[model samples]
Target: MRRAPIIAVVLALAVPSLARADIQPHKAIYDLVDEDGAATGGRVEYEILGNACDGWAVLQKIDIPKAGARVVTTNASWEAADGSAMRFHETTERDGQTVSRFRGQAASGSNGFAVFTDGEGGESFGQLPQGTLLPTLQTKTLLTQAKRDRSVLSSNKVFLGTSSEGALPLEITSVLSPRASTPGDHPELDGQPSWNVTSSFYEAGGRPDTGPDYTVRSIQFGNGVVQSMEITREGATARARLRSLDLYEVVECNR
Candidate 1:
C-alpha cells in the first residue's frame, strides 16, 4: 500500500543550529500497535544527532511483523546541512532479505534542485521545480512557517528522494497547546508547548479536498520531538507511542 514514502515522515528542523537553538538532540524509541490495542509486532527507533555547523543526521528504523514468519523492516538515514546539499538512503527488507533500496543526493542548482540517484541501476534522476525542498528542509520550513504565522495550517512540496517522482505536495494542520494540559507517560515534556499535527501527503498540484494519498498524525514538541504518531491508509491504522527519550547536550554556536 505504498509504504516506502511513509518512512520519511519524521519531523526535522531547517538546519542544525536552528534546531539546536530550539530543539534538543535526542534519541527516541516507540512501540507500535493497532486500533484494537493489539500488538502489531512493530517497533520504531529514531535518533537525531549533530549540530547546524556539522550538519544534522537523522536515523530511523522500523520493523513490522506479519502473520507468517515474514517481517518487514525499513531503515532510512538522512543528512543535510544548511539546505544546500542532502544525502539520503533507504532500504527495505522482507524476512531479512533486501527487497528495495534507494540511495540518492540532492543539491541546489542554478534553476532549481538537482537530484541524482543510483537506484534500480542508476536510472532515477531528475530536476525538481525551483521551490521544491528536500524532506529535512521541508520539515524545518514547515515548523518555521507555522511559528511565524502562528497558524495551524501550512503547505509545501517535498522531494521524497526515494523515487524519480518529482515531489509530493503536503498540507499540514497543527493544534498547539500546553504540554502540561494533557496527561501522558513522558512527564519530562510537561510545561513545554506541544502540537498535535496532521499531515496529508498527496500528488503535486492535487486538490486538497480530493483526499490524501496518506495521512500521519503526530504529537510533537515545540522543539521538534515527536512524542507519538499514527499513520492511516486505506482504513488500516498503525500507531507509535514514545517509550524512552534521551536528550543530548547541545553545542553552543559562537555568534
Candidate 2:
C-alpha cells in the first residue's frame, strides 16, 4: 500500500464553512512534528480566501528542513461556488531548487458530469466518477452530516491532486463526534464548539473492507478552523499543532 506524504495531507484538508451563514475566511499556521513527537524544524502555512459567491481560493505552503535538504510545496487552487469546477497549480522545491510543477482543472457539464485533466497536452486525463467533489463541497458535505448527528460521514470521491505521481481520486470515510476540550494558543477558538473528526482513505475504486491506506485525526471548529491534526500511515505518524491563527470576517460580494 502506498500513501501521500504527511504534509500533503494538510494540503488536501478543507477549512471553509458553508454558504450564507458562518462562511469563514482565515489563515492558519502549524508546527510540524515527526512520529516520535520531535520537532521537524518545519511549518505549514495554509490560507483560504474568497466567499460563496466567488467560490473558495486556497494557498498552501509546506516547508521541512532536514539535515542537508529541504522539501517545500506551494499550491494554489480555486473551486467554483456552484461545486461544479476547480483549478490548481502546484510547485515542489528541494534544497532551494524546484523539482516539480503541474497545473490542472476539473469541470462538470450541464448534465452533471465532470472530468479532471492534467499536463500541457490539453487532454482528458480521466473521467472522474459521479458524485466527486472538490474541497469546499467536500467540507460542506461532511459538515452537513455532522450537524444531523451522523457519525459515519461518507463521500463518494474526492479529487485533490494530492498524489506526488499525479492527481488521483480517493475515497474518504470519516467519523464525526463531539470534541473534548483542548487548550490552544489562539483565544478566539477557546471553548468553541468542535468535533473530533477521524477520516480514513482508500483507493478510489478499492473495497473499503480491505482497510484504509492511511488515517487522519483532526479537531475541527464550528467556524471552519482546525486546531490540530495527526496523520498516521503504516504506523509512522506526523502531526501538526496550531501555532497561530488569524480569522477574517466574511464579506458580501456586491454585483
Candidate 3:
C-alpha cells in the first residue's frame, strides 16, 4: 500500500530528537526474520521525517500475513517529542483493507502514558473493546500511578470481535523513560534506545504476542554507505547477521 501524503509532510519536519540521537538517515526497507533464520515474511517500511535539528523521528508501516486470504496492516507513527519524549499513533486495516477496521492513539507524558481507541477491529494491537472500563481506567488511573512511582510500562492490545471459540488479541508494546537512549549500535545518535526494553502479554500466552529479538550492530560496507544491526530472539534462537546500513538525515518538527 502507498504511504499517505500526510505522512510525507510529517517526515520532512526537522526536530531536536532526530539529531541528538545518532539515528540512521531516513527512508529504508527492513525485513523481519524469525528464530529459524527464515524471513517471518513481515515487512517494515520506514522513513525519517523532518531535519535532524527540528525533532527528527521515524515512521513505520508494518504488514503481517495470515493463513488464508487475510492480511493485517498497521501504519504506525513514532515521533521523538524532543530528546526525551516520544508518542505513537496507529491505524489498522484488515481483511478487505478499504475500510478502517481499527484506529488508536497513544501519547507519553513526563510521568507515564495512556492509549485510547474505539473501533470494530479489536483484534489488532491497541484497538480495544467498545467502552472497556479497564482501558479507560488505565488512561486516568494509570497516569497517576506512573507519576507517583516515576517508572511506568504500557502497551497496546487490539481485541477483535468475539466468537464462540474465544477472544483474539494483538499487541504492541513500548517502554517510556526519562533517560532512554538510542540503540547501542548507533552511539553517535543523541539519544539511546530505552534501557531495559521488555515486551510481553498474558497468554492463554500465545505466540502472536511474542516478538523476535533485534540487536543492531555497526558493520563496514565496501561502499561508503555505513550501517549497523543484529537480530537476537530467544524463542527463535536466531541471530541477525551483521548487515550494511545507510544512515540518513533525520528531520525534526517544530512543536
Largest lDDT belongs to which candidate? 2
How many steric clashes does model 1 contain?
2
Task: Give lDDT per model, in order.
Answer: 0.61, 0.71, 0.34
Q: Looking at candidate 2, what is the lDDT of residue 213?
A: 76
lDDT score for residue 182 of model 1: 72
lDDT for 52 in candidate 2 is: 72
Give the Å shift of residue 162 in candidate 3: 21
Count of clashes, each model: 2, 0, 53
Which lDDT tens digits does candidate 3 get at residues 1-255?
222222111111211222233334445444555555467665555555544344334554555565754444444444333322233444556566644433333333333323433355443233233432222122222233333554557655422121101232334243323334435444343332222223332222445535422221222211111232232334333222222234565343354
TM-score leaderboard ranking: 2, 1, 3
Off by more than 4 A, model 2:
1-4, 35-38, 109-124, 150-152, 164-167, 253-255
Residue-by-residue lDDT tens digits, candidate 1, 15-130:
22354366577888777876765666777777887766666777777777666755554445455556666777767777888877766677753455544444466544556656
Question: Measured by TM-score, how close is model 2 to the native structure?
Answer: 0.86
Q: TM-score winner among the candidates?
A: 2
Over the full model, what C-alpha lDDT does candidate 1 score relative to the true structure?
Answer: 0.61
TM-score of each: 0.82, 0.86, 0.41
Candidate 2 local Cα displacement, residue 213, angstroms: 0.9
For model 1, the superposed segments whose C-alpha errors exceed 4 Å read: 5-7, 11-20, 70-74, 108-110, 114-120, 163-180, 205-209
CA displacement after TM-score superposition, residue 149 of candidate 2 (Å)? 2.0
> Which ten contiguous residues of candidate 1 have the minimum total lDDT?
11-20
Error of 2 at 180 (Å): 3.7
